[model samples]
Target: MTLLSWSVIEYSAKYDAAGELGHVRDTIKWGADYLLKTFNSTADTIDALVAQVGSAATAPGSTQPDDQYCWMRPEEIDYPRPVIECQSCPDLAAEMAAALAAASIVFKDNRAYSRELLHGATTVWNFASDRAGNSSYLHRVIDSNLARQAGAFSAGKDHGVFSWDNKLPGAQLLMSRLWLFLSPGYPYEDMLRTFQSQTSIIMCSYLPVFKSFNRTKGGLIQLNHGMPQPLQYVANAAFLASVYSDYLEAADTPGWNCGPDFYSVEVLRSFAMTQIKYILGKNPLKMSYVVGYGQNYPKHVHHRGASIPKKGGDRGCTGGWHWRDSKEPNPNVIAGAMVAGPDRHDGFKDVRKNRNYTEATLAGNAGLVAALVALSGDEHGLDKNTMFSAVPSMFPSPPPPPAPWKP
Candidate 1:
């Protein structure tokens, strides 16, 4: 969640929307710091760290709700958080990779901080890339018999990330693409070539064409494209399209382009815009999955923080927090959040219990911010050579070919 939040805040700040750049910097620092802390604090020997923290599951048919039923702050939990740490999950590592790499660019002026982020990103990417595939430890964790016994998939069905196994390649591709855009020279050049190869394979399997499997009266909401798919898949593709568009926007200037196959930047931008609009409100559902986007947006978003209202005065922190599952509307709004999107047939039910349609997630937000950065358009005032644009100049200058072998 912190990673996703940072992705949005960083892009918004870079685009000058998450308040002023200075204030947004501080906010983004909090997230980056936490991710760094989480990775650094771990004593495990793995080169990568997990991106999630959650309690162990209850037995199937368990009548009692999880800790969330208590309706208390996370600090108030009776015990230390029980979590399954994927010390080397490639998907999680890839996400962290993208987050840190992006953060490094955002904080490029702070050389030390940017280097720290870069170092972390580079390490995680290396670990994830080395451990990519079906037999990886991450696949074991998500596709375990223990999880099946506990009905985790049944629960996750409400959240739309049902088949997490297939997402790693996409995450890896995006992370590699982003890293390639920001890096130059030596090991990075080698890394970029490796990424381009992986991207070719991934693109062929997931999104070979610029266009979607969308029909005239149907699209992602219909889920008519494939089996057990997550909205994030399409969303990730759109974000990649936007990334390509960003490259094109910098084509003549930033010195970045994927290949000769991609020339019509507007086509990519248009596809991105189409997905963004569908997410915002233009789907057959005619409802905005994001909070506060449209008149008919989802009210009962499945988020803990947004369900609670601000407490002050007599209503202090000690009190005023409880489960209030009423139709009175959430007293607080999780603004700028993107929920799990509509079902097939563009059907949607705005219910907190229907987490598949209402839950907000890190992957969802990461994709959202990427699209938002593009949709918000470029901040013309900022220096053009800041992030990806600055990459070409960072390459190591040759040593004049050893002075023409002056032996």
Candidate 2:
């Protein structure tokens, strides 16, 4: 949701000129409104929220196959789905805050709607901070211990990817960006600074030269952290890398220093573009991970909606197995949909049943959209170089030129 908001917010001018801004806003509003409904906005104190609706299973003990177990259209489900509510979940609350905050930016032209979104952001951010007190207490204790022992402290292990389950990195980046747009004398200035610092750390960790993450032989950033199915995460990582570069450009920062190494913004952007190109058919197999793109792409994407024929009569939960197992290309093309990508060796199997390499997820596509917008030419058709200057030196200036030879 946050990524979608970012896509429209960062590129609204370009999209508006292209006559697509209204459509994007309508789509983002649909999602934001649904998220708003998950909790009671009017309540004096917000706590729990409906975290999930339904599941892979249709009911507690029903023999009917559910969405995950069978290749059925969502419209075919006739059961009342169960819901999962959560309380005291800081991570979830923080992510909601990020989404609402970013959406508020997208609708800033609509004063009333923007205000409502900001209010929701404030509510959830408070909830997250309140629930995270225990962690803050532990950190304080650790700080005191270190003060007494004069011991060095580390920032601990880094997360390999910014993902749905782990929203800290993305949330922090959003919160920090919010600081720039907020009014003066904001009470949360300190917290926003912390967010900025943490966001910088996460981006620095992705530097290939830093050896913090592995890169595929084809130059795709691989932050799988040893997961068997890793390509699902590459899109999200690429999104963050691109978005961070946009942030740096917005702040007029030529580059950032990570310890002894000073990385120019070009370095960061180069890393992001590499990942994007790899997904768009720069890999060993020369296959585009996105459907309906490039000369070669995945034909048998693992999605029931795409696989089943529009005119077919066998659209039932159990009856679609023939289409699912069929060797033919999908009757419907999910254009611009990014599927889970190739293996470590840049190898990909185009078979429909290979869900690990064939599934197209909303989160993955959200990231892809935002990343594409960020890397595209700036607003008013201005190239990025025209808007931002050349890279500056990260170290001391060189000695002055020698005295003139002529007198």
For all predicted structures, in order, the TM-scores are: 0.64, 0.77
Q: TM-score of model 1 relative to the true fold?
A: 0.64
Model 1: how far residue 334 lies from native, Å:
1.6
**lDDT (tens digit, per residue) of candidate 1 on 1-407:** 33333344335445565455565467567777877775652322245365556544367654333454334444444534555556557667766666677778777778998888877766666676673333342233333363345343232322222123344334444435455445544444654555455444333322325332433354552222543224555566666655544543453433223345533556656666777788888887788878898888988877655665555213323242443344546667878778887765567777765677788876566667656665564542223344344334445566665445554
Poorly placed runs, candidate 1 (over 4 Å): 1-14, 17-24, 39-56, 63-65, 68-76, 83-98, 115-216, 221-231, 252-263, 308-325, 378-407
Task: Please tell me which predicted candidate would have the highest TM-score against the true structure.
Answer: 2
Which digits, one per residue and each the tens of the lDDT, describe model 2 over residues 1-407? 78788667666766667687797788789888887787875553587887888767656665566556567555565544678898878778778877887788888779899888877776776677664322242233224353233211235444536777765566566655654433123344655665666677777888877778777788766777544445556767777777677667666767777887778878877877788888898888889888999879999999888988776635676677888889999998999899988877777888898888898888888878767766776522212321112123224578999998996
TM-score of 2: 0.77
Error of 1 at 141 (Å): 25
Local lDDT at 260 for model 2: 74
Q: lDDT per model, in order? A: 0.54, 0.70
